[model samples]
Target chain A: MAFLKLESLRKAYGEFVAVKECSLSIGEGEFVCLLGPSGCGKTTTLQMIAGFVEPTEGRIILNGADITRLGPSKRGLGIVFQSYALFPHMTVAANVAFGLEMRAIAKRERRERVAHMLDLVRLDGFADRYPRQLSGGQRQRVALARALVIEPSVLLLDEPMGALDALLREEMQIELRALQKRLGITTIMVTHDQVEAMSLADRVVLLNNGSVEQVAEPFAMYEHPSGRFASTFLGKSNVLAGDVSGASVLVGDQELPADLAGMSGAVDYIIRPEKITFAAAGGLVRGQVTARVFLGDRWLYQLDTPVGPMQVIDTNVGLPKAVEGDAVGLVWAAENARVVARGAAS
Target chain B: MSRTPIALHIFHWLFVLFMVAPLAVVVLVSFTDKGYISFPFDGASLRWFQAIWNQKSFIDSFWLSLALGATAATLAVVLAVPAAMAIAWHRFPARDLALALLMSPLMLPAIVLGIAILRLLSHLGMTGSLAGLVAAHMVVVLPYVLRLVIAAAAGYDHALSQAARSLGASAWAAFRRIELPQLVPGIAGGWIIAFVTSFDELTMSIFVSSAGTTTLPVRMYNYIANTIDPLLAAISTVLIALTLVLMIVLDRLFGLDRILGGKA
Candidate 1:
């Protein structure tokens, strides 16, 4: 059964539509990520769910209750803001105990819960310290503890790790994912970082221009994007203009077999960089490597091919396979290339 | 990090002397042993300071001024907090105009304000009432309170309130727990400034106060008009000490730069 449902949710500011007809059904305990670039309405959609924003039109049903008209305080959802939003004047224990106090829980019970939550977030020793005294990662943990100590039905994270450094961000991401799994609370996170979304979410909902572009598992969305925006936004992709005839796509002079899904005229063939390889002899197409970038784990080669400008990534096992200015044949599996209708936004 | 040049260092000391000369002269005059205001006295005595205790009007007026300042400052702060929050957080129509109206007292000449307030109080039959005096003083001091609180509100992280609400705190609860504590420094600083401004007010208080409700400043003005003595100088010295103590407290509780410089 669907635990939370948003039906045709739309939010408009004057003539600008921030979220246009968004609809989704999330199951219980599912970790969903709203991934998109800035101004893509991912944050707006999350805000609507959290009751911070009221939709211009539509209904929000949570746990079999129509909560579209509910106020944020009445919604009882846990939210971690991008700034962490810890009370600067309050100690860590007092900050975490705030929600419990709001719920009118007994003082003894609130103290016990606050202590347990501090221990859970591994800040047991620093409970008396204020937020300004803690490091960025420690502050982030305190915010999480404050939110989760309420035992809310849904947990919402709005780029909670945005303030942390790259290394701290990764460490917190692992800790957050592990914590979510253990609690089995329905969690929704909004982030522009695709790598973070892919690593943290069970399902990634890609949005563009105030609409959902694609909703799929991380691997499936990356492999089979529905349109041009999704194909490029989730990860880098090489797009080549092509003509479809029968079961093959004709680009330049090479006819490459692609799953066109029947009706097609001018189409775009999308292929991931890692899917393409540097073939030594007699391969799909001939190209010269224009630029080569070593990305630690992979060698990224920018090439001028007969089809168009293309990119290929090869794993860095030992040494360089193809350097800049080298003539190389680019080859990929036929199933790896995807064909989509031309000029489609999503 | 760099040493002051000889010329600039001498200029700084001269500026300090220029500012303190009047107050220093007043203190020196208060210690004179002569009957009148004389530069070179025969000897130093504590008689002028003792004279302040013997004067009933001055003693009563001193307590009245303290009560009036504390009351007016507290009232101004109470009204300014909500006004500052509204002006800082919302985008309602005439927000800037409302803020300007609250702060207009600062721009208006004190004599003009005094005459206008005196006319209103007379028509309302409240010219000599304590409430009338407090209301006039609140108007003078509100701008200082409002400006600091507005600055604090602007720099506050509004997301903290949202986080509280999301964690199931109602609007009132969130304000009490999350918003009020964060604004303490601004409130305390504004109250101190308001109290000092109200205590030193003369033009407006002179217009509003009658014989029964004379404040210490008005009382001193009347006494100086009647006689020339070091007794007034002794009272002035006491006021100077009180102001210094308040300034030190303000600086210790909240950094002077953060409060007066509006650094938030």
Candidate 2:
């Protein structure tokens, strides 16, 4: 049985729906990330699971018990916010001890647990310091320690690294993932950053317009997106709009064979930028280089072809440079492109 | 930046001088040796302060005003914080109307409110009581508390509260652990303003105060009306000092910048 399950959850503000009939099940010790752009209902889904937002419909079950109407405190879930949410008035020790105090734990045990948690976050000596005294990364660690000190059944992180600087964010992401792994806690994190989601999540739940677009492992989702939205959202992809013809797609005068069968009529094909390569002599299609951007290790060439503007990332290994307005040959293996019907873009 | 014109500079200084002149005179006269009010020069002594200390009624009224001001300010915060939170957090159908009603007391004429309270208390047979004075003072102080706290709560990072809730804090726990602490500066600012308003209140106190319940401001008004002496200056000086001390304490606790919403 799954440790936590959300079934047909919906949240609406007036006539605007934030989360619509979303359902997911998380296994014990699973680290799931709800990844989406802002207003995509990722945070709303996390809030609903946390019991802060009452769902307009459906149920939240934990270990097969319905907890749809339970308050946040009764749900036994640990949450870390984007801003850390550490109490400014309290010391680090006090903040970590708050949950224990609320549960009426013994004072000695509370102190012991707080000490242990602070140590776990590498903040042992800073227990007496207030949140204002700590650095941003330290404060975030303290917040994590505070939440985990309670020993909740599930841990939720709402863009927990959003407040940190770029360097600290990367460092904390690694540290947080390690900590979560060490604790063996069932965790759900909401993030807009694709890199964070890809690195941390056991499974990434891609949401678009309040609905699940795809849910899969990071690599699988990147390699095989269910639709145009998922392919473009998870990473950068050059999408070509065309109509399917028998086993091929007609692009102006050029006809390219469709790699996937069952693709009919008007469809969109998603090809990763890196998947396109330069044809040395002759290849699938011919194009003119409209733009070239030097990206350190690789050259990003924007090709203007009959299909449209196609982006290709090429390694700069003594390859002849293609300048702007230069004619070039474009090529891609038929098996690399994933074609989907136009209606699935929504 | 270019220098201001000489004429504008003089006007600005004169405006500032006008504001400080009355307060300066009160402080200066508090140390006067002569029995009557005088300007510029007077033999300086602590005789007026000594005389103020000797007056049993002044001392009693001073303590009474302190008690009343503290009680009313505390009551105002107790009533205002949750009201401000509710107004800041939700957009209920009647929220606007509710906020307007809560703030109406600030615009209402003090004499009118005092009279209304007097009539109500008389009907309830509780006139001339401390309860009556506290009730009236609370009416005047509440809006100031509410306005500051509402501004504070509105400016607070609401995501912080959501984070707390996601971290397994109950609604009450999130409020106590996350939201309430951020509101301290605002609540303190509100408390200071409320206390000052209640302490300096004369028009309202005049209606509610009886022989045994006369506040410091009411007593001071009667004293000044009957006699012009350095003793009244000493009392005024003391009031000014008290206000400054409370403001400084608030500044020390939560920086005066917070009072102005941390702009500077």
Per-prediction RMSD in angstroms?
A: 1.6, 3.0
lDDT of 2 by residue, A223-328 (tens): 9888888888888898877788878887666777658577688888778889887775676778888888897898988888877888989888876467888777
Top candidate when judged by TM-score against the true structure: 1
Model 1 TM-score is 0.97
User: Candidate 1: what is its chain A TM-score?
Assistant: 0.98
Model 1 misplaced stretches (Cα beyond 4 Å): B1-8, B249-264
lDDT of 2 by residue, B42-156 (tens): 4888898888878999999999999999999999999999999999988789999999998998888989988999999999999999999999999899999999898888878
Model 1 per-residue lDDT tens digits across residues B57-159? 9999999999999999999999999999999999999998999999999999999999999999999999899999999999999999999888888899989
lDDT tens digits, residue span A1-346, model 1: 9999999999999999999979999999999999999999999999999999999999999999999999999998999999999989889999999999899999999999999999999999999998989999999999999999999889999998899899999999999999999999999999999999999999999999999888999999999888788888889999888899788998878988786668478888899999988788877888999999989998888999888888888899998998888898878898899988887754
Please list, in the order the candidates appear, how each scores on TM-score for chain B only.
0.94, 0.91
Measured against the native two-chain assembly using Cα atoms, what DockQ does each of the candidate structures obtain, in the order listed?
A: 0.88, 0.52
The lDDT values for all models are 0.91, 0.87
lDDT of 1 at A187: 96
